[model samples]
Target: MPAPPPHSPTSEEDIRWMRRALHLAEQGQGAVEPNPMVGCVIVRDGQPIAEGFHQRFGGPHAERDAVANVPAGVSLAGTTWYVTLEPCCHTGKTPPCTEAVLAARPARVVVAMRDPFPKVDGGGLQQIRAAGIDVQVGVCQEQAEDLNAPYLKRVRSGRPWVIAKWAMTLDGRIATATGNSQWISGEASRAEVHRLRGRCDAVIVGGGTAEADNPTLNARPPGPRTPTRIVVSASGRLAVDSNLVQTIDQGPVQLFASADAAGLQPLVDAGVEVIQFDSDSPSDRLAMVLDHCGAANMTNVLVEGGGDLLGGLFDLDAIDEYHVFIAPRIVGGAAAVSPLGGQGRNKISDSPVFATPQVSRCGDDVYVTARRVSESPPKSVSFNP
Candidate 1:
């Protein structure tokens, strides 16, 4: 039929447009849960031409949309396309993006890296080159993978994304021996704390935790809306008349525990979803709860805990990440609870929590965010009530 179309990035503006395409991909964050948000920029002869990003599951994927959106009649020869993830080859919700790329018939294809999947893995790359197109890999490999980790993680393990948040003293104490913790973090840090909660699908805490702390696990953001509040009470004995458990008409409250059926029955009667499991392991229970919520794209759980729960999750290696806020004011009580050091289980290794990098900030408080260093001893919360 017609000679497809011409495509080439022939100007500095063209290259800038390509960069903007990648930036557009960032918008998928928060919006593209359970799936990694990805951006793509197609250029011909180093000029900005077309752009796209993976917005939602049923929506058009980044590379495919970008290629298809290009205006007709542009010379397809001698143009280069930059995409975050390798264009997907197999069609699921949308058609194979590789086919779209080949149809465009650009001079060169520059992708972040080969796809790490099996079904559609690297098939796009092969298909394009098979059609006589030049392909370059690893333009920004790390960033691409980082941007797509949520989708990759789900694709690999059918599990939801997870992150842990806690406030510890300078000396690493989570609570005092007396068990009085009115305010652990300052205002700025607390504001940031709620922000993390607002982003998660659920917020989790312990039963003994809810009882002792009487926490309002609701992730109240600056505005009225907040994430669902979840309490991990294995005993399932939260005070029916208690303030925290009493329905505020705010949002739904949940409890995960193994308490006496009678004690929990009342809450169930009050319209609470009680996830009664055979055991009392937070990590195990959490995985099930997250799955039940339909972790298709990306969902996160922000855990704000006291010492026992924090240590438990670490011992189990269930914690995917840790974002700790440390107020500089020294509350060096001899028996202060720690973000990680308090007691559930101990490790023989000098530092059991093998870590990647610990980023610390002390604007109003010294905040430390760390990723689980290694999987070898990746232990998770081991509290059995």
Candidate 2:
């Protein structure tokens, strides 16, 4: 019988190993913006040897850490490496990971997905092949793509991946007729929102929300880092005594508004950074906010809303993901505010479509997460793997 093909179908064990690498990659989630989360594992003689993950921006690539962790006397001459992303071949903050892998002399390499950044693209794969190492690509590709969605989105679109989050009653109202929206969801659901906030680069809210809620908007039980706070208003009229303005000493807060908005001088005097946009149109204002975020290298933004901002983002088709918490209670009133309120669609056919949502229960609330169906798949560098 003929020998098996060099790059045969992936084995169950190989898939398991790749999943482990992917999980390790997630450890770098909130810390590696503008850089994809990457994990690497080395195996020898059917047993694992070393494992490592990209821990922070401007740090050593995953491959370097994995290779460095190999037991002092273990030779990598016959070992195989499994990496969530293609080994990088170009230098930026650290040396090329491809060079590091070549130095270790691994016998074979398996990559979950090709790096989409122009600097590496398929160059890393080519370099590995040139060195006579067997290469396999596309192991656990879907999970790898999902893991790097934010970085890939930023690299391809020049804007952060936007996620809109809100908690509303079963009747779809965010607040009562008089704008009383103290606690819609249970503690578990609220805690989940804070965890989501902690993972993003910034949390945005409308000026109306700032004045009415006086929310601090910081992540409770903070993680490795806290997100920047952003308030958007056409007139820039935010309450001077609001908690957001009062917490300027704790973290950075930015106000985006039109150039002529009133009462901004006081905010500036209070040490709040004010960004002036050229237009007052909701769509234009959102575009300006995203542009500023991109310039600041912020890859993920959580738009925690008070209706107007969320409605504007939906009208502009700017939201990439949605996380809606639906509580069981109902408070019916003609003047009650819905989670999204604007000049809505005239016909049912004109409504925006979303992918099938993932729904789960959080205490007394149902959590629904979905992505906009119109979003383009992350750009990928073409390679056989």
Candidate 3:
């Protein structure tokens, strides 16, 4: 390793610097759907120096790109690189960022977590050491990995990813006996849901759902900035002439299924882009959808549908966050709108299961937006969507 630069450490300033740099990571907040925020801190000869934070998708990874902004002649031969996670070494939607760090020739490397991922999994540290640089591991490892869960999940499982939306009644019901779901939630809450949809890259619904409800599927009151509409149909037929197809700015619809191309021309010609991927693997299915949208300048997707899709995703251990709307009423018939799944049992492991909903009331309806929890397992329950 090269000789260390002559300088003094600023423990107080460096810690504060790390915190401020981490905030720059949100640039990828809405854009980097499955990627979490990662920050980078660079120091030389004990003196805190250049810093970088990954802000969004297609944006620079914190360590590599940040090093670029540092004074060019300042030799990294003595600088120390600090990253929230293992630096990426695989060619992904972006380049293998490990090369970027290598190019800097930093004298030492300090990573917060072990890259359990196969592609880079320790490859970064190995590469750094190969070049005769010092490598340090496990600096705040747990917290850093927790911060970048989405990205880590994507790295481990190829999928577009999912976050569930829920709505219900005070007693945990979604609607009345006759399926009359009106005024259950108030104007303000519904309006917020619409806005959330607008920001999403697409809104996914199930096939049986489209035919049964004939739902417009468009983000209501927020339709102008309509999200790309997606329908999951195993049978391939979802009423081509519905209001949703005609009204949605981005579609007739993108269909995901094993359906024959011959039967889907009408939808295609009408303007929807149908992606025919026939697979039963939930992980594969999600990955294809996410790649399609993520590559097409769309990443964030909102799944707003009847309980079937919601429950299925939850059952698959796919939901990340939730929004549940509760109305003030009860029902008495078998016709009452229950959650996504019918009576059934699926066991869950003893994981960190908890819900924290920020309540907001509208008319007789109430809504709870809960933060994502860790270690969720499969179970039977009703979550109104």
Candidate 4:
């Protein structure tokens, strides 16, 4: 019930090791969706002896990897172990990592933050301490949370963390007045979008985008796995010949539409999975789609929209991150669509706010990344040790 300590200062050595762990975790970015990216470092006499990071889902955890790879005959008996996230204690796809730590018999453990999942919560920390190893948590907490935001969000809420991405011209138009939006961003920025797609569990779009672009939505320069392609529409009418519909044999392609919508049989016959939601409101429809994705254990979603879909998500406050690319060219037209289109906010206070705006250049385009400031922080589980 007491308030947490006021950002306790960390030692220089501890800070260095924690940052190393974070860098290791970043290497697993594209491969560890639906699971938290964790990294571990085993230190003896203030020097690192072994290091490891979670490589992929259902693979050995960071602690296990590090402990297993400790050089033969090098003892970890009195060493300290540093990890970005708390070691898991429960048995899932692999054995509990706590067992490995206990066997190593480390003198102490340093964790950036406690695991937020209810099942593991403080249980991992408790198990470590119960074996007589000292544990210190909340070191480099903010950076660690930033790295695992998607995993924390997915575990705390049923829905995956949503990122809405798009590119527009200087005049705020994603396309010309005639809906010709191909190549709005430069080749570098488009390649960056493909990299983003490779990191998410699913890439979502509106039916209009599918019909207009007929994109493959596959991760180019592909990594471990391709993201699932999802299309949302109220009418459930999609072009049967679109690349998304025609490539069902390669990967997952799903349709989320209203129950009353018609003309979905052809997609089903073409091997597309059609899910019907009973909501008429766009906000409700978005929520239903997210719920279905969550139930299927998707941890991160990318919304590459067609204006209306992005607008609905914004109006409903459903997006967590934004990756907007601004091209150098200008195309002015009253009929051209903006990145988001819906009922405009009536008051300045009603507008959505984002924080930590990071701007970078991708060739001729300016890329901006920001996080929603209104969403509550992920829940944390802790106990005095």
User: Highest TM-score: which candidate?
Assistant: 4
Clashes of 2: 0
Write candidate 3's Cα lDDT for 326-351 as tens digits. Answer: 76666556667666663234555533
Candidate 2 per-residue lDDT, tens place, 236-276, comes to: 86777888889888678999988888878888999889999
**How would you encode candidate 4's per-residue C-alpha lDDT over 1-385 as one tens digit per residue?**
2232233335778878988998898888868777889999999988899999999988999998898789999999989899999998999999999999999988888999999887789999988887777788877777889898888888988899999999999988999999988888999999999899988889999989988888888788775667889999888857789898877776799998888778889888988899998867777888999988888888889999989999888887788999999999787889988998777688998877877799999999999999977456544424221
What C-alpha lDDT values do all the predictions have?
A: 0.65, 0.86, 0.63, 0.86
- Per-candidate TM-scores read 0.77, 0.92, 0.69, 0.94
Compute the lDDT of residue 209 as modeled in candidate 4: 90
Question: What is the per-residue lDDT of model 1 for residues 1-385, given as tens digits with 9 covering 90 to 100?
Answer: 3332333323444334434655787777655555456678877555667777887657888887676667886655567778766788887777888877777777777666567667767888877777777676655555555555555556766655567787766676667767766576788888777777765666777666678778776655532234567776666757777655575466677777764555787887776778776645556765565565445333566677655566666655566777888876557777765565334444466444635656656467877777654444312212211
lDDT of 4: 0.86
Local error of candidate 2 at residue 371 (angstroms): 2.3
lDDT: the better of candidates 3 and 4:
4
| Distance from true location, Cα of 250 in model 4, Å | 2.2
